[model samples]
Target: MTFMKLKFGTAVLLGSLLIGACPALAEAVLHRGNSGEPQTLDPSQTSLEIEAFILKDLYEGLTSYDAAGRIVPGAAESWTVSDDGTVYTFKIHDKANWSDGTPVLAEDFVFSMRRVEDPKTAAGYANILYPIKNAEKVNKGELPVDQLGIKAIDAKTLEITLERPTPFFVELLAHQTALPVNKASFEKNGADFIKPGKLVSNGAFELAEHVQNDHLTAVKNPDYWDAANVKLDKVIFYPSEDQAAAVRRFEAGELQLVYNFSADQIERLRASHGDEVRVTAALSTYFYSFDTRIEPFKDVRVRRALSMAIDRDFLSKEIYSGAQLPAYSLIPLGIATYGEPARPDFADWSQLDREDKAIELMKEAGYGEGGKPLNIEIRYNTNPNHERVAIAVADMWKKTFGANVTLLQNDISAHYAYLKEGGKFNAARAGWTADYADAENFLAINLKKNPVFNYGRYDNPEYDALVEKSYNEKDPAARSKIMHEAEAIVLRDQPIAPMMNFGQLWLVSKKVKGWQDNGSNDHLSKYLSVEE
Candidate 1:
């Protein structure tokens, strides 16, 4: 009950449960709580999970994730790789059709990929397509969009040429950014196309209706290739920043599932919901980025000092109630599927030793020894747990090195927008969830030439070259070593101070079935069913 006090932003529709105007049916429906309103429905433009939740249902790419989070074929029934691994040829499913009964074709994917590479689109994840030959050039407007290495061989066949051999290219197809859009519908409707009935989809569900900041209703798409396996008749997703209110709704049976509850609520919910209260380790890192172009942060020592000063162990265990792991590296620890663990030099340091070294570094950087005490301000999105962590970090900085600290909070939408725009902040809270099961997904954000998610503006030629080398390395062991070197460069530079690794915590109804706790947090409605 104490967790009920967590305040929500104005967007959270407290107890409002409007289910659109659809007639009540005896069909199965799974009601879920989306963490927040999506910034955009355009798959190319979406950079957040809230948008991904809806887009995953609205569109299927060449491949998709299964219930166990393995990459499986979706729209493209099968694909073949050349001996060199630079070329891929896919066979589109003939039965794949959009919601409006239009046939899904190879041309659709070609158009979508070009759209992402177009500078006019300003897609945040455009760089993800850089593996395709000339994609980076096209995105930078140095080459024509048509030059991008993707072609529609025929209505049912698609061929793509990569700049280099990328082992994860097939798995990358499962990402929302790789989804195809109906070129006709997109051009005709333009900006107004994201609305409910106006959107055309080829996935398991189609947009039935949507109310901004309230709820989005998706009904099973009859035209979907595998619609027969889509057991749920409808799924309604409510977007709310109010974790407590969402939990309350889940308890009252108004909602079937809620996501990302506060650490304080976990124990209580675990006791009450038992098996329905889910927790799974996430391949994500919650960190704060510095504007490295600025004066103090421009100095690597100042950056390193501030990063080493925080007691991440204390913050994770004490403040977050052991809901997270203390992180010293940008990538989460022990994700060995991709490569060897990227261990930072300070990864094994004790809290007291780290703090002492932090002070020494600060003094060397001309601060905290009767010099101007380092002034820092941290900006983060509104969340009870985030606020607590920021406050704890601020306290740590002040106590350890006598640094002045300021805390600023913004709503979820505004917060991401501000960071994306390269807004100035001493340190800004940021997080990265894996788009695919690879270390490259996490490392790509900080690539010096990348304009997308590089909020820190961390420019290092050595780091950039190392990452590029990894992409082209033919051997897995060789590629991983290159990636490790790239990660180490950034870790030493400290453009982003590693905070804590995440574990997704969800409250589900006992009546809901087929939910799996996977690292990707990619549970699709196609696999879920509700009890009568």
Candidate 2:
């Protein structure tokens, strides 16, 4: 008990050491190995999934994800939707309080929603909130933040109106962008409120400290509305960019949960740790985006040829160790009710036929032994897995088109920031895990309206219209059909070349309880308990 209350810097160090030396001290302390350091703790300002993992514990949204990644009640005890299915009213429990013991009012949600869509705030994932009325306009600087459709009905009740009917609207609230900020703390400290000492969160845990490149610590929040049910006293997340070393740490008992270990280690891990090596199919796609705004790639033939030339089977079986399946379309299987996504004509072609056609396509695009030199610069984020994949793709490009290829690597944060901030490049690696199970979540990245996640800057009007039509369509079958059509257009245009459908390869310690494998791959620390 005494060791659990150690100060920030000292706690991360001595706690790990003391816990290892005294097994009794390790009870209720969880050391989670995260993919990388969070880019920012601010809900409105982050785009990375790693940051969402920590934010979910510190900030409860109107609706929240359960242990199974399904939508469930959170700060709002319950909510009702209008018969038209556009307006929603949420009732926050009077007992809901921030970490500082102040009541969480409905005005806080209104303020937070407005803040996230305010163009001045620059939320990278803002488009996800566009289902709310005027949210897109507000985020695009066309409308005033106050004009956003959220309203505080009373001190404890909140109402939100959507511009159009959205079936997935309730589930959308479970995203990190919908996490409310403590109005008092935010007003008092401004942007610094996300800092350790100033952040007044309302979830099961509160931020204790974040030592960059080391660990982020959160302790149980006594003031939380559901504090009585929270089992873990402290949650410490360690950024494990070097996953191999992280596996070593996991083997040494320094970390109870290690995520995204190198796939090449799957067999050895299974033999050694048994069920601790959690492997499952995930609704995620790893793809490379050709900068549609730039040349060589500006030609559709060049983009399609390069995409077809890559031997996805080799990448899946050889590089990923058969953990992932080769993907030919942006939408992966088992997403919502969208059914199977439509694939391009080349999807069923053999590798040999695809390569021969790729060569012919390259020649037609004026590359190969005659016209323009195909000097491709591929940019991928830092990770042993991503680097290996990039090198393999480079070799395939060289073999197929005799293209001069260069690979650019940057740290995770910097790499994504460069693409998101509109830095120019020829081809860049991009991966998407569905924010919701909907196909729109995957296909919407190519939408011109989504400048943040639309890294390649692709702006196809027909594709955009079909996606928008699906959102407003009432019939589920018709909506899914519209979305499927939208996916087809992107595949034909080849804005992004889908390489693989990810199989979530993770290591969850058997000692941790309440974890369920789900498509979205979100496991909240609040729902999990650490066992001795």
Candidate 3:
């Protein structure tokens, strides 16, 4: 292991070398590539990909998770959890300030949370704030927005009250959707606060410039509370959809960091860079969701038959090229109560017997080998690998069940629109990366009433009750049991056919130090320093 002590002066020396020595620069350009462009820079309206990149530079919540998945202080210097577990009091860091030199006050959090739950703002992930007392009622317009439970007791102190005890509440606050915003800037700019040269940030970096769909540049924030610990002077982010081209750029020394490496590139980079090519299991599950409200799929037998006909293992190996693991359930391994090898008995749809059973079920559902082909459309985003996987599955379904399946490929924005508006498609590819280290993050979203991300509309009163019960149960063992039952219910319904667990692949230059990959695939560039 390389044991180089990091200090303020040492960081300055190394940063100088990064800017002065390498072709890309010792300044750590932090070039990143993704298939989807950042939809919005507004912390409340963006998705995970944009949020993860913006988090390094522009936002700060009360708490954050470390690389080890432990909770740590961020904007809040310290906090106290009430004995009843319903109230939390946070002390803001005295040194924290916005990029414009205004102090980041506790009232900023109050205004930010209110803005997210306000129905007019239409924050996509606003359901994440449901734990706050009366948040749901306020969001639904059943109660006034000011009735929400968060309050700024003073300039530097914030108090929050929840409807019930929630162990994951602190972790939930760490999410970008819950990050604090400057009330003054927000009121002045309204919806235009995210525009270039108009944004103010409280995180480790400040937005230097932004060119839509092309590139965004951020420089280190000198006013950040932990600015002394941040090493890089600037980070340049590029939004590119072509993974192969991104890898070419990395190989040509035009970029220093790249995410979502192609399978062929992974093999070649492993041969050359060895340990520099890193792959880790991500807390994500890619699945095919059947709109239960749509025709033909309303039948549970049809859903189960579709799930059984496809082979998850074959798709993972052939299409993913050993980049992912076959998934059997919504909750990926290593989450709460799911770390055990054999806890829940989700159906093993990959088995050979299951294939035979699927054929039988198809015949019973009035579609068989010699009957009329079950015409269906399978939708997926236009990533090279995702489209390839959809094509492979379409072929598999045609061969196994004699179902005539058509593949529809759309760009990321269009795909999201189709899912959101309930467009006509028998089935579509979808996935969820865990927001926190909880099974609730996976199973809760599928509830019938969840407005944000629940595309399938799968609902069971029994399962919903169990999810609520687990949240309040203080006993770990009891909570685990309840969550296990909830997972069983979701798998049995098969609203979504679980296909594979994602594995994140990143190609980084050897000179980048302290860039540890986490289970969530979140890259914290603030903790990284370039070495000469």
Model-by-model lDDT, in order?
A: 0.86, 0.90, 0.79
TM-score winner between 1 and 3, please give it.
Answer: 1
lDDT of 3 by residue, 345-364 (tens): 32543367787887787788
Query: Looking at candidate 1, what is the lDDT of residue 521?
Result: 87
Model 2 misplaced regions, further than 4 Å = 1-27
Best by TM-score: 2
TM-score of each: 0.93, 0.94, 0.91
How far off is residue 228 in model 3, in Å?
A: 2.1
Q: Give the alpha carbon lDDT tens digit for every residue of 224-262 in model 1.
A: 999998889999999868888988899889999888788
Q: 1-532, model 2: which lDDT tens digit per residue?
A: 5565666758689877887899656558999999899999999987788999999999999899888878999999999999998899999988999999899999999999999999888888888789899999998889899999999999999999999888788778889988999888888998899999999999999999999999999999999998999889999999999988999999998898888988888889999999999888998999999998888888899999999998999999988899999999899999658887899889999999998998898899899767688999999988888999999999999988889999999989999999999998999998998888788898889989887788889989999999888877889998888988888889988989999999987788888898898877888998899777
Pairs of residues at least 3 apart in sequence or in different chains that clash in candidate 1: none
Order candidates by lDDT, high to low.
2, 1, 3
* Shift in Å, residue 384, candidate 3: 2.2
